[model samples]
Target: MAPPAWTTRPNAKDDLRERARELRRQHRSVPEVAAELGIAKSTAYRWVRDIPLDVDARKALFAREHSSTTGHGQMMAEARWSEYRAERDARQAERVTGAAGSVGGLTQEELVRIGAMMYWCEGAKAKPWNSTRRITFVNSDAGLILVFLAFLRAVGVEQSTIDFRVQIHETADADAAVRWWAAKVGADRTIFRRTSLKRHNPKTVRYNTGADYHGCLIVSVRRSRAIYDMVEGLVIGVVRAAGRPSAPCDPWPQ
Candidate 1:
């Protein structure tokens, strides 16, 4: 039999065309066949355009194209979301700053009330089952710690009687944290009890890492038996004053 038409061509074009067609028949994509054969995609497609893909081949092509397009679209969406988040965060910050400005210096009574409420939420309390008045507060927030100190001062609690130490994971920079806490709370290193080191857990994924992580400060006022009762009274007063009218209780004792 006479050789097929393409074998008589003077150059490799005939071989490339046949190879491109063979790849297309084997379900290879136009770009893949063009790349292997060193031909333009358009030229590859022109050669293989008449080759019909079966249902599975069409589905595979669709999946590949969809995956590429979806990936590109997702990246664009993430970029837009990042921009939106920054703008939203900035606007929220402005509102927060404005709201903060509305609050001027707190009065002694206000501090007492605020501190009592704050302590009730985060501080150790004496339960009815086992009653012992011990005033202890632990927190990681610097602002709360500072406010609590102010509250103690307003209530006439001497600073000397207060005991403080940091509680942190053993993996953290314990020395740096101690120094940071000393400067932050205006306390001497000599005063703080030995820091409480938590044993590290290999299974845990900890997010509270980095230079800013100073660990939680544990503050306990020695000889606080009386102060505990006073705080309890202050918290009760606030509850009575702010209590809703629905509950049948004697109108807060005058």
Candidate 2:
């Protein structure tokens, strides 16, 4: 027993707590600090429970890990492509310099009109009595929210203006899902409103969690013109990026 006591090590919780305190002092995140110290995320959380943090430590951590060097690389790539687009647009504009009086091809006004039409047709909600200035899409698929958000941004809608709400079954993991989506879009949880849907039959097969859940997001446009233009650019830019030709069509084609 004495030999076994000699071989045993003392509890290191105090050491871990001290290290965690130091990391917090240096503005290190719980997850990063945990990873560095070979501890669990929960342990890190517990250690920092009593400590006060000026900013959201968890989010700060996630952004540092996910949006650091990799995010910069992607941004640089996008910037290079944007420059190429500007050059191409200038060349195209030069070609149509003679047709300035007429709205012929690849003009700024034409682009704006095209973008408006595209947003009206695809993104905006249409009703028999009135066309609501909102975009509604159905999905039970996972990760669609992120895709939709990216699309909105591509079309010119600022992330700040976008709102999100989740419609889920009453018994489902609605809270968890909302948290996950919030983290994904880098948006605050307050932006999400959880609604309950009653299921009459309890025996029916349904996806309750993970990627299989059947849920949809209600996306609304507070600024219609801006949203429309953004969407139009997104469509044209995507088509051009794919090396395909896209012509603007009528909003209410006969």
> What does each candidate score in C-alpha RMSD?
13.1, 23.1
> Per-residue lDDT for 161-212 in model 1, tens only?
9999899999999988988999999989889899999999999999999988
TM-score of every model versus the real structure: 0.68, 0.38
| 10 residues in a row with least lDDT, candidate 2 | 244-253
Pairs of colliding residues, candidate 1: none
**For candidate 2, lDDT tens digit of each residue in 38-114?**
99999998898677666676566556655756685357457879999999999999878857656544544445455
Q: Where is model 1 more than 4 Å wrong at Cα? A: 1-71, 244-254
For model 2, which pairs clash? Answer: 155-230
The whole-model C-alpha lDDT of candidate 2 against the native structure comes to 0.63
| Top candidate (lDDT) | 1
Residue 65 lDDT, candidate 2, scale 0-100: 55
